[model samples]
Target: MKLASLKTVSNAHNDSIWAVTWAPATEARGALLVTGSLDESVKLWRGDELEQDGVHTGHSLGVIAVAAHPSGNIAASTSLDSFVRIFDVNSNATLAVLETAPSEAWLMQFDLKGSTLAVAGGGSASVKLWNTSAWRLDASLSVLKSDASVKGSEKTAGKFVLAVAWSVDGKLLACSTMDGTVGVFDVSRGKLLHLLEGHNMPVRSLVFSPVDPRVLFTASDDKHVRMYDAKNNSLICAMSGHGSWVLSVDASPEGSALATGSSDRTVRLWDLSMRASVQTVTDHTDQVWGVAFRPPGGEGVRAGRLATISDDKSINLYDYS
Candidate 1:
């Protein structure tokens, strides 16, 4: 797989662009790219031309994460102040505003069926799950510390959940902490399955293989991306090359490739089958905070597309194949 720079939107936002996701296509419109920034706004861009569609600006602080519903009609954005705003993708109508007390939000994601929205609870040491139907607090999967003492101080102990992901089957939920521990949970039972360990620094991003529910990938401040077997809690492999922290990692829908953004100011595409980076694009002047692959399936769409947002206040679109 290779990435050909299709377009670059310089100064896409006033401040750092931290979050990005693809709103799936509908009969009325094609797939749109949604991005959130430290400028306290979420903006939409349509087509390969990267035309600006609209912007929503009510967030009090920097927007840390953005997620799109599977149906492409709804999307959500979270801010540093612990607020989650869900809105209509096309109309930008506010659907719901979710607030999590005792926890701040970091990353947001929708499950495969789009029935639930998962938020990375920054200081709560948990994953806050919200029901999409009534926009209610569904459940909180708290990560238990290894220490048996001081259990009451779980909220203050500083796990600082930084990233979250769900298996394609929707049966498994994985979350990573600032200390690099990854917790896997059983969604139906609401139970913690196991903890995977390797890195000593913060784990900023992770994604489950779209084709294989058991395989999981993670990027960390340790400057390495590790793959694991979620069910068995076994480390499968580790790939390293970035000169700085690896901030984000995403798997292609075909499951044959992975894309990662880093503090090294570059985006690297990995060949999963070979466990190595095959292509590197060094176009961003600042750290690349987010990298996302457009989910396959939209009218007249065939070629794969990948996007990267950066601290340089810019967004880059690439044609992937």
Candidate 2:
């Protein structure tokens, strides 16, 4: 499979675009592209033509992460100021604002059921779960630091949680830390299951395979993407090629492929079975910060789509086939 450039939106934001996700289609509209930027605004783009649908402004600092609810009508965004704003995707109306003060919010994801939203707690070393129906704090799953006396304790100490992902079944939650440790949690029990260790630098992005809940993929500042069996806490394989930090990663809906964005200013398509990058796209003039595969659903939307945002202040849409 390859990605064909469908449309490129230059200056999509006043500053660097840091995050992107596809809001699944509702009966009223097809899937919409949601992007958050350092410009302190979150914008929505509709259709393959990439027309602007709405621009949301409330963040005080750079918008760092954006997540779409499974229901498609609601979405959430978080900023460097440590606030999560949940709003209506179509109307841009505010639904709730979650203030994550003591622990900063980094990346976030709504569970597949749309019943809970998990926010990566930056310095607290935990993942905070918010109940969707009441928009209340449900639970905080804490990741314990490895023994300080261990060989590489200095590098792992006082690290911040940077990224998070949910398993296909929503039964598991995985989060990555600035020190490169990936912690897997049992969602129902609020327990840390295991830590998948391999990368020595910060891990910025990770995703669980859509087809297998136990399989996970991660991208790191170590300039490598690693696959692991989360259930067994075993490293499956590690693929490397990016010249700089690998900033983001997403698994295709079919689970046969993976896509990554890197500080190397490229987007790479990986063939999962071969455990190697099959194609590298150098479309951005600066660092690529976010890459997302469009979620399946919506009328007449069978063709796959991939959206990528970058430090170049551009958004690129690709036909993934």
Candidate 3:
């Protein structure tokens, strides 16, 4: 219903923290808070006290996105330089390093089954999928195709892919581009199903509802969050409040609520049933870049938790119930 501030860590990173996600708990430990930053480091924290568990540094540029495999043993991170590193969560051992050149990698996500890693290709106008078993390049799902004669730089600038999301069932994959087009694809057949259009500005973040696979939510530079029925290709509704770009969005595990981070330097809690923002938390001094909900299942981990990272070089934890 609402988020109550539990703890705040200042200077959590040397520079701006750009991304955050919770690694599911294993028999050895509870879920760990994973954060990537402009400092070119990825750090892991444990418990509500936010103790530092580990720090990984290899990225040549600022880390842009981080994702945890469903099994919780493996994690991956992408940097601005377009390189992806997949590593072991507990041992911090490097598992694989993927070089995405020609096409840039902006955001990445592991499917529900952890069989594939999907990276939003910034300039390729496609989503690149890697097979987890072999850690090999699997396929590239093109969201937009232009004339072959179009110059590479011009084509990339026009339709850069910024974000990607997997449906609850892992049957569908949705990717958003710089031109405000959201493409829904059928993973099995590797075909684009439809494009959801409404916002004219870049759509930076998106997610599929946990309860309904067909329902999708997107945050855009247009300063509004729009809900759509991806399967039907229909816009359901749009909610507005953030004064600047909506940077990130995540749905509650129960699918009844949503959480978002914005350039307005605030984290907002949205009541999905009401389709409006119910609470705003202005705890960061600069832009709020990432917000994530702790995944369910752990040793006696029942209470809900939300973690947010900001350009202020801080991390905030909230008690969600």
Candidate 4:
């Protein structure tokens, strides 16, 4: 299937859509999309019409990360303010407020079991874990100083934690940092497991393959996307083509393809088996910050769907299949 932009919602957001995730469908509500923006607001959108369901504002700075709980009833968002806000998806009501000052925050994610939330602690050199039941710090997984760890980037100023992903089983957590180093950790043990190496620029986005626990993919400012064998901590392959920085990357729910948005004003589709981009959508006039494949679950929206948000102040939807 080829991509023909189905709809473009111009000025849907005031700034870049930094993160996006699909809320699974419920008996009462169709699947919704939760997006965070540099505008310092987290917005919920009705997936079908792209209508504003609601907006949650309180973050002092840009909202960098957002994830929907597996239960679909709740979601969590983290901001540059070092705060994580857990809110009810349906009502857009605040549920829990989590914060850590000494350990700053970046991207965040919830485990598949919906029992824990993971926050990438920027510069704190740790990934902080929170218990969803009590909304308290459960553990802190420290990054190691091993000789084998990926060397810090010479050009980058920070080892600031930037992105995070949890294994499908919720046992393994991988966090990427500003220096382009990815640290894999064993959540239950609170230990640093291994570091995935390759990119030499900030790794802005990372995701574990939905169907494989040992596979992880990362998007970096180095203009490349890399796949990893998480269990062995080895770089499997790298896909490079974006002319500018790659801001975000996501895997399709079926786990057969992936999507990426870049500062070059384009969104790309890659077939996992071929490990090559099959199509490029260049409708945006400015940087495209986030791209996501809608999670599969809704009864009616039974198609492969992709959404991209741009610094052009637009949100574009495409049919993936």
Candidate 5:
């Protein structure tokens, strides 16, 4: 896929736009993009222009997580206060406020079926699963360990989960934590399954391949994105070029390419097979916090689409081909 700048909404947010997700296009609204910022606001954009469609508020601290319910009718965002706000993507009305105290919050995600919500439980060293219908936390898959040095540590767990992803089948959930641990869990059984190892730094972003359940990609402060054999927890390839921390990552609908935003103030597009960056978007003047490849749908929207948000308080929409 190639890259083309579609639009740049300057001062899109007052502070860092730390998280983003694409709300699948609906018959009534078309596909929309949602983003959460450190300024404590969630903003929505309309059409291909990426104009401000609306804004949702109530977050008390930096909004570090945002996820669209698989159905695209509802979306959720989480902040440092450890609150998850589920709201109507169209009317912008609050649906439910989910809270898990005693545990910090980080990246969030909804199952492919839209029946469940999964959250990376930051300080709790676990991934919290919630029943979407009741909006109640159903099970907390704790990162139990027998690896002696970690199991009994009192350092408050640098294994603080920072990001998570669900396999395309919705059967597997992988969580990346501050301690550089990638825990692949079996959600149906609420059990810890396997741990993927490679990076020694905090893993900030994770995404399961849309086409391959056996494959997963992760970005970290180590300035590398490694493709992994999820089932076996084996490293497949390492893609590195970012000069600073890679903050967010997502794949296109076709699964042939992926996008990453980094603290180096650039958004990069990578060819999965080549394990190399094909394009570097240097438009953002500050650290790029998030990047997403819009899902393929609707009647005739061709060309790949990539959306990026930055600490510079801007949102950039790029045409990918």
Candidate 6:
């Protein structure tokens, strides 16, 4: 597979764009792309044209993570202030405002069914799960306990959960921590199954394969991306080419390709069959923070699309073929 540049929007955000996700198609609209930034706002953009749909702001600090519900009608964003905002995608109306303890809401994602939301609880060393319908705390999957003195300090080398992902079946939950440990949990039983440890630095991003519930991928400050078998508790392979930290990763809908962004100021497309980067896009002048593939399902949506955001305050759109 190859990526052909479709559009580039300079200064797409006033500050570093930290998160990007695709909202599925609704009855009234086609699929939309949403991004969160250090500018403390979440901006929505129309598909391949890269046209701005709207911007919503209320967070006190930089928005670190944003996730669109599977239904596409709702979305959630979390900030450095440990606040999670659930809002309407089309109307831009605030639906819920959830405040986690300082440093708890580092990353978040909605389950495949949109019935539950899981957050990587930063200093808390747990995955915070929320019930979407009632907007209430549902479950907390604790990975490790922090040292008493370093409970909430960002500078501490504790088990700070930095990323979270759920399997397509919604049966497994994985959370990666600042210390580079990935914890796998059984969602149905609320139990910690085991910890996958290969990375020593922070594992900042993770995603489950869209095609396989047992295959998991992770990106870390170690400047490498690792693939693992979540069910068997083993590492499958590790790919390294980025000059700097591998910051984010997202699998394609077809499951044959993976896209990643890094602190090296480049976006890479990995071929799953070869287990190597097939294309590297150096369009951003600064670190690339987020990359997302447009979810399958809208009207007249046959072509594949990938979107990326960077610290250079820009957004890049590409056609995956």
lDDT of all predictions: 0.92, 0.94, 0.93, 0.84, 0.87, 0.92
Q: Model 3 residue 175 lDDT?
A: 97
Q: What tens-digit string does per-residue lDDT give for candidate 1 at 1-321? A: 799999999999999999999999898888999999999999999999999998987889899999999999999999887789999988889999988764568897999899999899888888989999999988999887556666666544548898899999999999999989999999999898998999889999999999999999999999999999998999999999899999999999999999999999999999988999999999999999999999887789999999999999999999999
Judged by lDDT relative to the true structure, which candidate is superior, 3 or 5?
3
What lDDT tens digits, residue by residue, belong to model 4 across residues 1-321?
456677788887788777788878888877787888889998888865689898988888888788888888898888878789889988878999887784478778888888888888877777888899999998877775545456655223465787789988887899998778898988777778877888899998999999999999999999999999997889889998899999999998889888999999999988999999999889998988788887787667687778888778778888878
- Collision count for each candidate, in order: 0, 0, 0, 0, 2, 0
**Model 1 misplaced stretches (Cα beyond 4 Å):** 145-151, 154-158
TM-score of each: 0.97, 0.96, 0.97, 0.93, 0.96, 0.96
Clashing pairs in 3: none
lDDT score for residue 106 of model 4: 79
| Predicted candidate 5 versus true structure: per-residue lDDT over 1-321, tens digit per residue | 689998989988888888889998876767789999999999999878887888999988889889998677899999988799999999999999987784567888898999988888888888888899999888888775656564455644577888889999887899998877799987778778888888889999999999998789999999999899888778899999999998888988888999999999998999877879999989999998889888877667776788999889898998988
lDDT per residue for candidate 6 within 1-321, as digits (tens), equals 999999999988899899999889998899989999999999999978889999989998999999999999999999988899999999999999998999889888999999999999988878999999999998998886444665455533568899999998899999999889899999999998989989989999999999899999999999999999998899999998999999999999989999999999999999999999999999999998899999988888899999999999999999999
Worst 10 residues of 6 by lDDT: 147-156
> Residue 62 error for model 3, in Å?
0.6
Model 4 weakest 10-residue run by lDDT: 148-157
- Model 2 clashing residue pairs (backbone): none
Superposed on all Cα atoms, model 1 deviates from the true structure by an RMSD in Å of: 1.4
RMSD of each: 1.4, 2.2, 1.6, 2.9, 1.6, 2.5
Give one digit per residue, the lDDT tens place, for model 2 in 143-207. 87556666554543656899999999998899999888999999888889998999999999999
Query: lDDT tens string, model 3, 1-321?
Result: 999999999999999999899899988889999999999999999999999999988998899999999999999999987799999999999999999884488888999999999999988889999999999998999886556897877766658899999999999999999899899999999999988999899998999999999999999999999999998999999999999999999999999999999999989999998999999999999999899999898988899999999999999999999
